[model samples]
Target: MIALDSIIGTLNLDDEQKFITYLQKKNKRKDAKNIDLFKLLSKSTLDSKAICNQLYQTKNSNAYHALRKRLFQSLIDFTANKNLEDENSIDMQIIKYILASRTFLIQKNYQVAYKILDKAEYLADENLLYPILNEIYHTKIQYAPNYPKINLEDLIRKQKENQNKHQLEDQLNIVYAKLKTVLNSISHESKIINFEIELNDILKSTDIELNESLSFKSLYQILAIANISALVTNRYYEIESFVLKSYEILKRKKETNKQLYYQIYISYIIANTLFRNKKFTSSLNYLKEMEDLMLLKKGVYFKEFILKKTLVEALNHNYTDNQDKAISLAETILKKKHNDIESLLDLHLSLLMFYFQKGQLLKAKSVLSKFYHTDQWYIEKASIDWVIKKNVAEILLYIELESDALLISRLRSFKRSYSNYLKQIGQTRILKFLNLAEKIYKNHNYLTSKTFKTDVEEAFERNTANKEDIFVISFYAWLKQKINKGDLYKTTLKLIQKQ
Candidate 1:
């Protein structure tokens, strides 16, 4: 059953009263039982038994259930009618007028029908609703015999123009949808290698010509695809170029239905690119811009943008060795409520990494504890890559705490599980890091011995040269710090800054 609060919230007090009046009028009764029940439930403090007794003079479960169902159905009907009355979409209004015109024609009211049809045609043409315009043209052609003022040839030509425009828009929308699906599916770093190839294939198959004649929708789609592809491939420079170009286009176009989205997307791409390039201060500036853009639009997408902005800011702080700032931002994210399970899981993993980087083993373990107890439903909802990162964080925590026995056991389990998983997914870099970390842990004492400092240096040089190994969790920096007896955080910050 729909919650009483949801129904009440959807309709304000005035609307709820209006709906009740509508129910009474529809049922042809001055005293509607459902109205009494709705008023009782709106208070929301009374128990079901009290409401049932008050309405029916008895505490009967079956009667309460029946009344609840009836109220729910009435609410649905009221909402539908209210929406129909309040709708403002030009396309939908055009369709409504066309239907009304057809009804009038059926009633032999030719003058009224033609007047309504003319209004619909004007609305459709003004809004560039080509499909609706075609419908209006067809309606005009069908009734042209009754109205000698109508020019059949002119109507046919207009219909052909609208049909061509409709076909073009449909093709662009199809390409946009396909690209959006591909972007969603290939979000992980491991899957990024195929992103460019997949995008190229899509472009080839669609045969879309990106030229001056392309519509804003097509331009937005192209920018989105390029932005996501750059992110996946870690091509920050390429993303920066796209961001600058898209920003110019958006500024030139002024406000549109997707203006806010484009603004947020460009800001996020710029911020993330700076972050990846180790320009933390510059990245923070762009992130602040993203936050301000988010404020202009208050909705679910806005909330999502805020979460993303916070996550990027936290990473920036963490990479710059500002542990306190990172921890503060991460804590704020954790305190807030989120409906997006994937984002929540990502925040948890990031927070855990921040605590680990700060050498606060206990705090890191606490973060992992929260992760461990994540709802099974949330676990299922999380991406496979995120879950793998969580597992890696857990292993890292065990190693940091020097829990040798537990670390060894967990490493063995992780090897068997993740080796096959990563191998199958072709994430060989992560697999290599896992294997290397296990080997280092087993020979920890030997590696730290005075005579083996050269060995550690050699290991660092080998891992750093590969590029892929350094991309995975800074294991090379950790080895360098251990070998030189320097601060791990300082070494990590320096290494990243150098990059």
Candidate 2:
């Protein structure tokens, strides 16, 4: 039941309509209830038992379960057909060519078979479709003995090269999987581990080179690994040059239409990396390029990357003193059904931060309430780092509301769960911030005391030579405003400017 709802929820309005139309064509009986079940699941409002009651109007679990199975199968068929029709058009063309060439080969039409295979091989080579190319090469080699024009040795050599590329892609996929596992471990495990070293070791095992003649998809994976590593380790500044250089190289290549998806994603990674490094203008510039690229192919990839592009833009605006713009942008995304759960959580948290900085406690709390998922759910969907940030923000919001009971409970839960992990990561400043907040909760007078102010200063002593992450500074400014009794928004801006 949950799986059905998840699939239904991912479809947009046009897709929903297309699925309905498809069902209309495929349903064999007027009494078929798969469409009804689909509609109920699409709304995502009721439990399976309730849905069964509504659909059957009786205790008929057998009929209800069978209907669900039918509806689920329909969804799978519809999505698979749509993907081949839309996203895999080039692959379909290549497949058709291969099939047509095989038919000719079987008929002993060697001249026409070679010509058809030539077309297939050309299309595959243009797109670096290595697997398809291998198939085409194998077909040629099988007929090499009968065809005097066939270069059997050259065909074998090309087949070997294609196999190597495919193997490299497989190796990179393993590295990507390893990276995700390590990141999840960092989020969930209490054991101390240097994520940067782990990432480097996994990447080194791949022995992949930036300048390797890899497919665009493989290159995108490489950039994604670097971006995720930088994100987790706060090494955006270190990877900024590498990401930018890779994008530049990609742009210089005469990429085919098939490579546009990877190209757009690579640009997004570059934009996000720049944003992390506080190069707001440059980040926005890259975003503009990404947006233009998204316009290609009638905006097929636009919806795919809209959340990410908007999130980066909003973050840049928020840090640039355009919180209203940021809030407006973020609010627009929340009204739609998006499968990008991680980005949705990020947008919600950003909205919470924006409203919190404006001292709009009610609005901040409203945004915070949208995070209704469990900690385990968030950990699985988002990350442990995001969960920690959300927890801290909730504590601060409760404190500002003077909801002592809720604040105390939340503070205790956060400390119990993350204190040692934070200490392991050398983030004692966050622990100190919570401590000061707790002190203020106990004795409001201490919030403005000189001794408390000095403690805050000492706890968050800034290294003037190194710029702080804008988000770190934002959290620190909240504590500063509590002591100075100043505008939270202004204090945040001041700290950002100083950085």
Candidate 3:
């Protein structure tokens, strides 16, 4: 059986109440302890042993395990029945139509069966649900002899075409999985790898194209791959045209709500990409579009995308010289419990930057303290890139705080931990940055020298395209602030504006 407590933990207050009522109606015995077991599990504070003792007046592993099994089965049933009851779910509606069609066919009602199949087929086709359409086509061909007007050859041809589409979808699914693996594995690495080229090579091998003929799901997967690539390689500018084109095709498709999840996510990708590429105003405009889409179906996906929406909004606002607004947005989200651990970590680090730039050293140090988890925990939960950013930020904060010993300690720890990884990822600039930061911490006079400023500028690449990643610029702003004796926020904005 599934982990009973894990599933229980996912239920909200209303879901828990509905589940309790469901159990009440289904309970055959007044002595049944399944509801009590569920309630204890939902609380998630008691262990299995403690729960068993309370339920059985002793340590009864067998009884507790049996009750847990029953609860898991009930959750399975309730969730399945809930899906069937969701009128907004097109997949469930198609399944209902297909099952009804099958029932009518078994009852020898050929006219009704054909009508139901047609409805199922229309819905499936509109949603690009090729697998379901294949099943519907199979049922139709099986009963084709009962209806003289049924086009047998046409049905077979359609099935073949659908099989091709489904095969392509399966290929894209593998590509999506591969992209996710690469993203999770190499997010910490620098520009040593040409991830976009590697992904393009894979797509070329499969002959996949971002075109109108591809289904909504396929386009979404392709866009998702591009988004991951952009995130990995920091090349959001390169994928803007392709993402926009795929979005246009997504809009032209029928039954948009059927793929609402994809639509919402694709909009997020666009907005985030625009933000990364320094198109702040356009990014906010698309964020508005994304919010409108989130309001559909009674805001089913609002909670899911809230962190992402807020993150992008804050980043835009932060870069646009609205540091107070950015900090407020991030702080508001941080107060809530969100599953987006990565985003939360990001917000914490962003808050550090915001407060640091505003010359609020104490607040910046407070934000730094919130990163209480170990480096390994952060690397697993977020990314090594994030941990690196956090470490660099902490070192900078310590420097500003004039904690010489702590600054030296953090500088040494950072180098000892990431020096090899930086070399492995061809990020020698970061190592050089650590050296410069250490030098400044040791003397404090070298940071303002013309020679040190030239060395700093030479250490980092001045991209001809002048479109450095925002986080990269954020980290460099500390150095720039020292070099020019200027405002941190102004230095960051000037650096980006120079690009």
Candidate 4:
């Protein structure tokens, strides 16, 4: 026992090291089984992320990246190999690819993502690729359909092809110009215009089938080729009568894949025209229908645009009373920014009017705080949106019997600042905004109402008389009329007369 203890305690460093080396050598000699066990890890773990992490942690970079790639390959292989009961199961690979592409897009590695997405797209024969492909196409469509590298051989061939394309394009263009020329041509009779005559013949014979037989690209070429198009030249009833024929035929013929999409744009255009004419209710209904059919989140070009549309729709849907969803939707927009100066200002002023009318001063103050973020918020940048809030506030202020001094002062000061900005921009015509606001603030029911009504008659009367004015004028004229008949105008008149 004494001899053993002394040997252990007083062992030399070399002996101790030699002893450890002997043990390590013995341990290293025998583990084909453990290597086999490690090999089995490829089957043991199906979690792609976990496998990737483990591989990296174990100093296997090549294996880690390989496994990462195999995850996608595995999904596609599974979809291909397995006899799946669910279509969604087959689409799992597509989902993975799309999500991965989005991740790369979010990382701003566009080329890599685009290449990967293209591969994914080729693998996919489904229509789900349309939205993705459309986005990818748009990223470069302005400069060229496909670019960054154009084949010299193809370029030479295309230049030769372009010679023929130019001839065809030029002929279509000449015909198209003839249609445009008809709009400026003075005509009192609906059935007697030169443009209408040409348009009638085209409508009678040409259709998707006839156009196809002539090797033309559907409505696009015919729309391009017609010497005189009726859309611009005809006024409300006449244009509607012509357009409705096409619209009815299109609606009844059983829609193709993209027909619904065309309808969405058409509805949007019609809604825009109606909104221009101050047909807010009609516009709201049209927009609601279009939105119901739109691509939802997938179609949102930007967060701001979508939010603004939703906010306006929410506002436009209700009359006399403000909806709570407008505020919530606005708040949703605000959370995406570091206060979101533009949206906050819009929401603030909207509430300032809505809450002030409802007599909820506290709520109005809370809403106005959102607009305080911008040091110099420019209304021109947000012209149409700013107009809605400012005008609405003026309407409320004019009508409210219990108008707060602070609120009136702030709104009036804003109007003044906006007027100066308008002057500076050499858009003195926009000074009408101040004039309208003044009437609203002063509760000039008759004057504002008169202006508003005339605005509508000008904007909405279908340009039957060939009088084309802008949307703002029509919008303002309509609002003025509303104020005159509104309870606000009545209340204001009572107060003014008493004074």
Candidate 5:
């Protein structure tokens, strides 16, 4: 529904204007009866405005009946044109049938619009081989399925065919084949967490069987999800081979749907890479373009778009207006439903940073409860969260340590719980004791007595995160050492880096 439906492909400014003029001259957008099938998809937002109010209210309504008539008539037109000697002229006419219906979708008759596509697909399937069919299959399947959509056996057969043929040169085909898998995976009522996992592994694996039942460009678009997911985990390096393979194939394309869709996918991948690598400003810019492009029907699935949008929102929001809808959806699915706790940790941590930036201490504290002592993560989440905890504590310490009235008032204004987990768990545990030590140190009551100094050193010694994540544990230890009282800080950093 976005305006300025993308002027896709390699169309120069003049050519872009020419296309826009052609649409205007055709009077296509205004033609409720004519229906322009030439422009349904152009890597631009299919501004539903063209048919937005054109829906037929009754079966006998003039526009409704006209649509029904066109559906059958277009079929005949495509059939007759397909049998013609020359291919060029015939192709445009059949393509027109597809675009007309695309406009009709905005007419609010999803079924009629889908029905036309079904007829087109049937005619096209009869007329063209699969590579082209794959182009429309995912989109059509979303609107309506020609066959039983969830033919798992059929999909499995296709996957096997692809597996047998998988190779680096066949990378494009392989990706589309996987896309068919992606479509099938989500078509069912419940979310298929394992399917996503499989999808991700396929992207990260070096031993790909480049078996493709579809075109190369489609494959790139399909694999974009896996690549983006990997990017979030700082594992973009794992997907580099697949990403390069996808990009090369896309670069060779002559700007068809596959190419356009691939551009959207790769651009998002690039934006995500930028985000993960901490190029925040560049990531923001690229993701804005990617989000716009995706709105133009660039990505597949509500899940993919929502997840990516969440990432974009997290990076861009300043005033708490955006809930990072994508991230929220990801958290709701991946955390609450899929049990992807590691992912939840990352998503929650980002939101925590969000709340922290807003100085919404109460909300930050609420979120921190979920993050503080998770058992699931053995990787980035645990390490990063632990580090964040220390950073916040140090902030508290610094503000309180000045022992001044203004800073004390400012600290109190934060009004967030600084972890009663310490009180519950007792002072023997590092998190608890450090909680008290930070409070005391800020009051300047620490280092006041030999007993207090002993307490501080004891807490500092225990500050070492010995269980796992040596980079984190060791970093904390390093700080302790620099402060002149840490016991294992140096040794811990050494061991963790070895990991």
Candidate 6:
């Protein structure tokens, strides 16, 4: 049986009271069992036995369960009805208008039916609800024989225009879907290397023409595909042209549901592009713009944008040497609820890194403890790159703790888990760094030796030159500080300030 608390939690206080009142009115009983059950389950802590005893005068599990099922069904019905009344769907409005027109037509109320049809047509055309417009056109034609005032030629012309728009929308959606799917599947190094070529191939195969008259949805899709491609291919500079074009289109378009969504998405893309290009201040500005746009229209996709904005802001603060701000933002994100497991894992990893960088060993350890408990779940749910990052973070944490035994054990386990995989992904430099760190930790006597220091410095130089490992967290910088006998936090802060 579903938990009573869970069902109650899905609703607001207003909705709960409405449901309770609905049940009371429907039952017309002085003491309705379902209403009583709802009140009891609404409590923070629910004791099924006590509820059963109070309601049935006996502690009966079967009776309590039966009442719960009835209450759950009633809640579902109430919610469903409420949702239907609260829906703001343009397509639904079109259907309602069309059905009303049909009813009026059946009663031979030609004037009222035509007026309703006119409203439906206007709503459909305004929203570009082409599929529903097709239905509207069919209804128009069906009633045309009954009313000669309905011009068949005009209706046919409108149908053709809508059909062409629908086709264009379909093509754009297909290209967008393919680009997203392929981009998501690009985990291997080889795929990343050839990402641009693959993206071009997808665009070519889709045969979508990018012209000035392109619809807002098409333009947004183009920007989205380009943004993702630039991100994965490390070509941040390529995104500016697309961003400019999208902005130009958005400026020309009037405010609509599609325009609002496109604006939010484009703002996010601009922020991400600036972030990737190391323009942290500018990126934060764009992020604020995105947040403002998001606030203007809190759509169903609001939480996704919120998470993205939060993560980017945290990263910007972290990279700008604002550790306190970074730590605060990341911690706030960890507290917020998220539906996606991968996002939660990413936030946890980011929070752990922030605490470690700030020298908050206790907070870092607390985050690490949580990470370890959830590591297996993450590994099962996330990408290989995510797993690699987590392993590297764990190794770094162990090193910081200065527990040689645990560090050694972790190093060995990391190698066994990822050494071969790193080589496959052209990240052998990471493996080399891990091996070097393991050797230094094992031979504690040589940690301060000139020879060991030179070796560490040389390894850092090699890894730094690779550039591929630059994005894989700055283990090289950590090694550099270790060899130079400088504080990791101070050294990192100095480097960030220079950036």
* Highest-TM-score candidate: 2
Model 3 off-target regions past 4 Å?
1-5, 24-58, 86-88, 188-197
Candidate 2 lDDT trough over 10 residues, lowest sum: 461-470
Query: Per-residue lDDT tens digits of candidate 3, residues 390-413?
Result: 998888888889997888788878
Ranking by TM-score: 2, 3, 6, 1, 4, 5
Candidate models: Cα lDDT each: 0.69, 0.84, 0.83, 0.43, 0.45, 0.72
What is candidate 5's lDDT per residue for 24-129, written digit by digit as tens?
5544446444334323433334334343343332334455445545434543454454335233343455466578776876665666766666676665544433
Please provide, for model 4 over 9-122, each residue's C-alpha lDDT reduced to its tens digit, 9 standing for 90 to 100.
332344334434433443444521222222333235434345445545565656655543433343344334432433234256655766786777667666676676556555
Per-residue CA lDDT of model 6 for 275-357, tens digit only, reads 76667898999999888878764444466577778877887888787878988887877775565566677778778777777
What is the Å distance of residue 235 in model 6 from its true position? 5.5
lDDT of candidate 5 at residue 224, scale 0 to 100 = 59
Q: Which residue window of length 10 is worst by lDDT in model 4?
A: 210-219
> Higher lDDT: candidate 3 or 4?
3
Return the clash pairs for model 3, or none: none
In order of appearance, the predictions have TM-scores of 0.67, 0.94, 0.89, 0.36, 0.34, 0.77
Worst 10 residues of 5 by lDDT: 1-10
Candidate 6 least-lDDT 10 residues: 464-473
Model 2 misplaced regions, further than 4 Å: 151-154, 188-191, 464-467
How do the residues 416-473 of candidate 1 rate in per-residue lDDT, one tens digit apiece? 7557657754666566556656766777776657645565545445444212222353
lDDT of 5 at 5: 31
lDDT of 3 at 347: 79
lDDT of 2 by residue, 389-485 (tens): 9998999899889898889889988899889888988777789888987898899788768989888888775533234666777788888888777
